[model samples]
Target: MKTIDPINTTNPNGFKNQASAALEDTNLQTALQRAKSGFIEKRKKAIHLVDDFEHLKTQAQQAKQSALDNLNHHLALFEKNVVASGGAVHRAKTPAELNQIVLKICQQQNAKLVTKGKSMVSEETHLNAFLEKHGISTAETDLGEYIIQLAKEKPSHIIAPAVHKTRQQVAELFKHNHELGERDLEEIRALVDEARAMLRKAFLLADVGITGANLLVADTGSVAIVTNEGNGDLTATLPKTHIVTASIEKVVANMEDAGKILQVLGRSATGQAMSTYTSFFNGPRRTEDLDGPSAFHVVILDNGRSDILNSKYKDMMRCIKCGACLNHCPVYGAVGGHAYGDVYPGPMGSVLTPLMKGIEQATPLPNASTFCGRCEEVCPMSIPLPELLRQLRNDQATKGLAPKLQSMALGIYGWLARKPRLFQLTMGMFGRVVKLFKVSHILPQETPAPDAPDTFVQQWKKSKQGHSENE
Candidate 1:
């Protein structure tokens, strides 16, 4: 089997070009349209079934916030418990460190074949590529992840990694890759079965398995994994060694707090009351255990998250990776995730990519929002995404990353606002010019100038005059 090469998928700098290309891709547009409404409606229906979704959101938010407030204590407790349960804990300050640590473990195990469940952190570190470059064979067990892996592409959506792929595209990919020899590939079930059959062999023969954690229970030292498919469980148990890659923010104070977050996580993510498989692995299997990985390792990654904890964007740490914001974001709907050009995409990604990578490297990501407030409205964690995006834009201006023309225009507008009469006079002249020359084309395409007879200032003056006469 051919392995994924080390590819540079983090291209936030090329957002404009990628977004333009995404807009023109007919197949991508079809896939986006098909998945968009289903995700939105499902979340709405699920949330409505609850008596008070707001209360649930509050509880989850509080749980996450409390954990973050005492993050050090919780992480230490988690590590201690893991060690107590016969599991080892490894801390990585950077992505390179994470890859190196995982590589060291793989080398120690003399692993040839490795299987993986869906891990966004691994994607962030590009773990598969790194392992493959070191001559380790990796197989993605998650159906969505497997599809993208076959295509040699990065995940487009957080939960739905292959959301950008159409059914036809997937069939073609399978046909090219799999030697099933003219088996029926038209139906979704057939495709799923094909993937399952292929991965089952990898499951039994795999030397190592890797998965991501939804929440790390600090009290029990448990890694909670939620998945609709049973693949995560299989991936974790089938191999002798199981590795978990997670960020430090994933650690909650206790199982109860983790439960609180899980209540809303399913509703906000996939509209399930509980996912099909919500498994908690405390440690490796004991001697009496029937079936489980013998060796368990938890790799806790910092990767700038510790800095974020102390920063103004600390509110962002509460994100559950639910992708509710992505489903509702109009900007995301229009351009799709590939346009963001990073491991993460959409509202959360826009704010996070800039912060995780440098603001300078991901300058365009922060500016990718419509700021319609839907993302924050639907957020289970109430992350204040628009506010964060605005702050990033402010940072861009502060760092001189914004365009000179845009900065000068905003400066002139700010100066004019200080003198109301002068501002009104300047605006009146500009409005007339815009109307006379039909220069609305110069404005943003999404928000063209309204064809009103008079400006708001002119209308306000007329209303004031009428009130004075009546008095």
Candidate 2:
């Protein structure tokens, strides 16, 4: 088995360097271009199919908000029900604690092999690396997860973890990893087939399985996960021990609440009415049950989410992990997820990373946005992503974490804004300098600085004069 390296989580400050590198990588650019359009178009079509998608969004938002308002009570109830159903619930206040809890369970089961479904919480905790270090072999069963596992890379997109890999790149990775001689992998179907074939063995041989919950139904203590492939079901049922790693915010009131979110989740995520497999696990298998795990445990990780719940940015907790924000974000589409240098990426990440990590550690992430508002517009839960990002920027300035040059420039602009005439004069002079130096190249490509003969003030004044003369 190939050793998997721990994901680099200490580099939120290095976003600019990573973004620059991402721009220069041809393979990454190719992968990103192919994916961005498909996601956008598919979502458009899926949303069109729904008669009242906005109503569904509102319902989902309300459900999440209600759960959050009564978070402690819901969590307690969830735990109570889990124990009632013969499953155990463990709480971890930190990533290390979560890993330790999972490790203890694996040890208790004497697990030699673990098969995993897609779990962003596990990714945030870096569970695979932690478990592997303790002499356990883990296999990723989700096709995208499996690809990135073989390549030893972090997920570049939330929904499509291996979205940054082109078919050609994936073929190369499979060729280098798989022992099968000269198999056809040029097509997308072939790549998926190869992964399925590889993972089938892992599913049968694994002693334990770990999966993530899209929603944790507090009413019945059920772990709900949706996947395109049926791997999540296999991961949860085939093994003797099943572990679910989830964040505390994932809890919803009941199955009805879960359904409300599920309505928008699938449409907003992959442009389907629902994922191919929407499986819910109540607990371990009963004597009367047909097929399920023998031992079931749910590990809920805080990892700064509790702090977020009390903060002004609590609206972020309402997120359903749909990749709509990422798909619609210009910055994310341009640079891809890896450039953010964190577990989460794109517009949501810009607000989230700084709040979870320190502002000083991820100052660039907040500033990465153009404040286009597309992320907020497309977000199913209506998270004010751009507003949240601006607030983060404000926090950065408050802490003096923003660059000295930026602060000085903003200070000068603030002073000029108080005096209208001086502000116009300064802007006029700035416009001339821009035209003279041909500095439009320094501006964003989408909204380049214009080389117009007159500034807006000059144009307005001339128009007023012309109107006065006509009168």
The sequence of per-residue lDDT tens digits that candidate 2 reaches over residues 198-286 is 89999999999999999999989999999999999999999999999999999999999999999999999999999999999999999
**lDDT at residue 402 of model 1 (Cα atoms):** 99
What's the lDDT of the predicted structure labeled candidate 2?
A: 0.91
| Alpha-carbon TM-score of each model against the true structure | 0.94, 0.93
lDDT tens readout by residue for model 1, 255-343: 89999999999999999888999999989999899999889999989989999889999898988999999999998898788888888
Clashes of each: 0, 0
lDDT of 2 at 458: 79
lDDT of 2 at 459: 77
Candidate 1's error at 397, in angstroms?
0.9
Which stretches of candidate 1 lie above 4 Å from their native place? 1-10, 440-471
TM-score for model 2? 0.93
Candidate 2: stretches off by over 4 Å:
1-10, 438-471
Global lDDT of each candidate: 0.91, 0.91
Q: Could you tell me the lDDT of residue 243 within candidate 1? A: 98
